[model samples]
Target: MEITGNKFALIGLGDFGAHLAMVLSEKGAEVLAIDQNMDNLEEVKDSVAHTVCLDATEEKALMSQGIDEYDAVIVCIGDEFEETLLVVTVLQSLGVKRIIARATTPRHAQILRHLQIKEVILPAVDAADRLANKLLFQSKLSSLELSSDYEIIEVDAPDKFVGKNLRELELRVHYDVSLITIKRIELKPRLLGGTREVEHIIGIPSPDTVIERGDVLMLFGKKESVQRMMAD
Candidate 1:
């Protein structure tokens, strides 16, 4: 869960493994990247704490490198079932504490699950879900995922909400959303009498603050409620 120690071994330095290694390292984790391919190892050598050209399926070789002592081991040789299975089997035999694996197909996921691998990632499916969410909330200025069920989105106030105030909407009571902030643009007369649009930020608006048209709201709530509010 925490990726900041020198306690992770990332095997099969493919795209996923390499990127993960770099990210963990960037977050202050000392990552050891292993790959049978010299080119793969070379590409990520300088980025990680260590890079090993290793045939990880060999139990003796894997253990010799002390990979079993790591807090977690990640297997990314998913396309090569035999190699991946052997690597995981060796990790188990060595009593590695935690294992994360990538699943190339449904069958691969099932097989890994049968091995009692607790965390399995299906990259394509994960990517597709992310793309779908991007499309679903594309109209929003931005969307931040706080958890699987909660999100914060900055969206244009719904048309029906124009001229309505926070108390009148009863957002929390009705929609389970909190109007955190409102960015308002209004025309104000200058000292010379000519009016110019001045920007005003309403921070944590009171119950009676009216929601004028052209207001951008930062709303926080459950994903379902936010989605429903945006749609309705």
Candidate 2:
């Protein structure tokens, strides 16, 4: 995760931006933090490589600080759309390699897209989607989208499939699906400087491993085939 020798600038020093700066710093990036508010700048002083209390829209001042040297710039001014747009345009004009922006609304996102901003983040919307999924699909077990028409899902092993090896199960012949992995809970000792044990299943499980109750069997197939397998 080291970002050594890579320069990154972040505009806005609010909660979202501050958190991102801390993470990037921890990952070994040379982070330059910017905010108009002195208090916000002070808050992240210890986490970043440098902090500047200046408006990002000041193109000359920003350039003086060598904004062009940065590998990427993240515009995180969530409240002021105009300021965000200004900063984005300035960054683009300065030839920054990549620009990522945060938008608070769909209309703002549309505006950024029209301006040719390559990346836009709607944190609130993404958080809502994750929360809703957790609530409604508490028993989802595991799910992954392979393509528009295909998916892979792992669910708690049903009673009928207990003690059956994957070969005996004949998943492809009978259900037109493939067993991709077997997930089971096992306690492992905590690592050095770690406080808790980890529970994870090994991947690419052996063929003779028998399915058991509470075991999560990951399977892959076309959407229709997966749906039929789960229905049984």
Query: In TM-score terms, which candidate is top?
Result: 1
Measured with C-alpha atoms, the lDDT of residue 56 in candidate 1 is 92
Candidate 1 off by > 4 Å = 1-6, 140-232
Q: Count the backbone clashes (under 3 Å) in each candidate.
A: 0, 0
Per-residue lDDT tens digits of candidate 1, residues 149-222?
Answer: 66676778888999888888998988898888887766554332223344456777999999887788878888
For each candidate in turn, the TM-score is: 0.61, 0.59
Q: Quantify all predictions' global Cα lDDT against the true fold.
A: 0.79, 0.78
Model 2 C-alpha lDDT per residue in residues 1-232, reported as the tens digit of each score:
1123567899999999999899899978899999999999999999999999887998887998899888878898989999999999998889987888888987787788788875677777656644664555445544433577666766788888898887787889988888877766543322221111223455786667788766777777787887677688
Tell me, by lDDT, which candidate is best.
1
Error of 2 at 116 (Å): 0.1
lDDT of 1: 0.79
